[model samples]
Target: MEKLQNREISGKQKVRSAEVGTDILKALAELSPATSLSNLAEHVQMPASKVHRYLQALIASGFAQQDQVTNHYSLGREALMVGLAALASMDVLKVAAVPLAELRDALNETCFLAIWANKGATVVQLQQAVRAVTLVTQVGSVLPLLSSATGLTFAAYLPEVETAELREYELQADSNHPLADTAKYQQHLQQVRQQGLHAVHGLLMPGVDALSAPVFDAYGRVAAVLTVVGPGTVFDADEAGMAAERLKQTAEAISWRMGYTRP
Candidate 1:
């Protein structure tokens, strides 16, 4: 029994050491490309002596480095390798699968994720709410460039060269379209960018409300679009409502996991 207790204590100590190491490494990355030891300790909320001990171990493991002259520390080559590997392995659909399900459960609305393709915003994944009898869209369904909250979000973030032809075609197809005027359309796109999300009321379907937000990748490109659909009364409140905030938070978390940091 004494031996067993000792083994348990050893295991716990090793786990704690690992947690501290990771915390120190995170602080190093947050304060990078370089930061003084004092700053790092304060950032991690650890004593300078304790942090210094961890830094010594990190430097030994090639996960961190300290300038010989200035004593400032930064993430080392091994840390870079680990970060690149993590970034490379991340997939938007896989990363967002759980969050999308959670968001659907929280809002009790049909939620779907889409990616920009030659056909425009194409639905790729979906989570259906319990009460949603009729599906709003399905996998491989290509949504309209001007009529959908998802499409407008992709348009607002994606480069003009990729969307120009479609925009022109959509405009010429409908002469009386509200967004037919170039200036007016640009203004609408600007609003989506400024607000970090786009919402539509019954444009995609009658008596339905949909809100969409963009998921960004490491390079800050729009990797996917996340959208939620419900009956018109579901989102009676404006953008500041609980549903919109939840959508924004979910999208932002997915973006962060995909390695995007807002500049």
Candidate 2:
């Protein structure tokens, strides 16, 4: 009888734990940006102490994080990894593979496919040139919003509020390296949006120039960035230049494959 009772208790404990975890995740998902402990506890209708305990477990498991300064809770790297794994299996990645390959082959430049995720622009795929140059980044690398061409493509397309939040986040995360003056950054983003492409010449890394264009989804949302990186001498930045035109065309092709119809 004692063994059976213990079994029942164990089952009940498992169900209760799952319920609390689900509630916590649901609350976090519904809250924008990050949620304070008090707010999150209230949202889940749980005691603050109880919520904090669960959050500690979540943090340990890489499912959530607590900002040391703000004490706000947000999803963590493991959550992002899970989402990226699912995104990788999506049809768009499969659809983009061929055109991305063609673009790299034609341009003879290193090509990257970067997707906008919770953390910002992240490189998901890369194809290196036959004679690869000294590239620093790789797949799974996060591009800085104010620096990388891939990140600028996203900054230009994402909503203003989101962009602002991201900018603040970046500033807080990298206090040492501040972004450019606001007016200058805005002007750069304006040009990127107008031209549908952005280029950086040795901004983040010496001897490397990169041109990036956005790929939109069926709903006209910027879904990904296609970036071509090569030596500064070979990667043309002029809008009418062969490399720029080819990059834009390839991005358009991928966008079309993703069901985006030009409006």
Candidate 3:
């Protein structure tokens, strides 16, 4: 009878632990941004002490974080990783197919999509122009950050720390390029951020020009860059020109499809 009682107690403890964990996760999912311990306890209908115990476990497991300044709890990096993995598994190319085709037709130039691969921006998709033209870039080409418009678009929107690292690497690698000048390079990036676009003329290759814009993910991070490339004579550099406007519009549309909402 003592053994039977012990088994019953152990089963009850397991059920209680599971319930507490589920309640905490559900409360967190419902709460936006973050919530204080007392408020979370109230929302989960659990005692503060019990909720605190579960929160500590969650924090240790990287499912939650406690803000040091505010003493509130929020979802942590692991939660974001789970969300990103789910998103990455989706068919992004399928979602982008229509907009890419439309942009290519409207601009009458080659269109390409570059994603953040391993360490740099790598071309993943391309829609060729109707008219035959000599194209140097391929599907798997990793673009130079200080030269290609697509790479510049990524540099403009990525987090400052990441951009700083890339800048250092680029400067060391392309010491002879004009963008090696820190002041001028920063000013150029600022302009790209303000305009939500970037253009390069004869930077990547002589007589070649490109315009590019960033596509944001649900987390408001740059997920990819969309670019239009052609001969310098035809690929106008005017910020207010039709091509620029169309490129920006198409990028915004693609960002929306990727679940980015304007904050």
Specify the highest-TM-score model's number.
1
What lDDT tens digits, residue by residue, belong to model 1 across residues 157-219?
Answer: 999899999988887888788888889999999999999888888897888888999999999
Error of model 1, residue 137, in angstroms: 1.1
Indicate which candidate wins on lDDT: 1
Higher-TM-score candidate of 1 and 2? 1
lDDT of all predictions: 0.90, 0.84, 0.85
Where does model 1 exceed 4 Å of error? 1-6, 233-237
TM-score between candidate 3 and the true structure: 0.65
List pairs with backbone clashes in candidate 2: none
Ranking by lDDT: 1, 3, 2
* Model 3 poorest ten-residue lDDT run: 86-95
TM-scores, each model vs. reference? 0.88, 0.61, 0.65
Position 170, candidate 1: lDDT: 88
Q: Candidate 2 at 5: error in angstroms?
A: 78
Candidate 2 residue-wise lDDT, 1-263, digit = tens: 99999999999999999899878976886785699999999999999999999999989999899899998999888877975675555566777888989998998888989998878889998888867464666899988887788988899998877678778777787665545467777887898988989888887788888999999976798988999998887667666689999999999998877767787
Candidate 3 lDDT for residue 64:
86
